[model samples]
Target: MILTKQHLQNNFAKARETNSPYVFVGIKAEGVSEVIVIPKKSFDAKEQFYMNAYSEDLTHVMNNNVMITGLSYGDADQIPNII
Candidate 1:
């Protein structure tokens, strides 16, 4: 998902409000595409489950939820510093 500047700002604000330690950052060919503030460790543990979910499935699963999925699992190269 391509996130607009406002979307990022909102996510950051949410992260601050919730006092989250980690945020899911998605990177595409162009640059960073999305940011999701994961609110549950259980959800983070199911990374593969979220990774395999289709976009439409993600839309349904993420309805009224803080966790957003469907980011490419293999996009690690995009952030060499983090790796």
Candidate 2:
């Protein structure tokens, strides 16, 4: 799924008010992805100050929850590594 700028802003606002983290998964490219954790403060700041648009891609399994996937599960592990 793709998150529009407005959706991110709204979620950021909610997270700011609740002092919670907002998590999102984004596909960086074909066959690659990333999980983003936006802290309350950072979310507020980004939404307040950043005017540029942003988007996030998520997996079909994860859906709209806080879970993020696509990270590598291996010996030399990286949070967003593919394969």
- lDDT against the true structure, per candidate, is 0.39, 0.41
Q: Model 1, residue 18: displacement in angstroms?
A: 0.3
With a 3 Å backbone cut-off (N, CA, C), the pairs that clash in candidate 1 are none
Question: Residue by residue across 1-83, what tens digits does model 1's lDDT show?
Answer: 44333443454455456655544544332233454334344334444454444243233233423333323122234233322
Native-referenced Cα lDDT, model 1: 0.39
Q: What is the lDDT of residue 81 in candidate 1?
A: 31
Q: Which 10 consecutive positions of candidate 2 have the poorest summed lDDT?
A: 67-76
Best by TM-score: 2
* lDDT tens per residue, model 2, 1-83: 44454555565555556555443333343444455444444654655542343324322333334322332221232334432
Tell me the deviation in Å of residue 29 in model 2: 2.8
- Give candidate 1 misplaced runs (Cα > 4 Å): 30-83
Q: All candidates: CA RMSD in angstroms? A: 12.7, 9.8
Clashes of each: 0, 0
Flag regions of model 2 displaced more than 4 Å: 22-25, 48-83
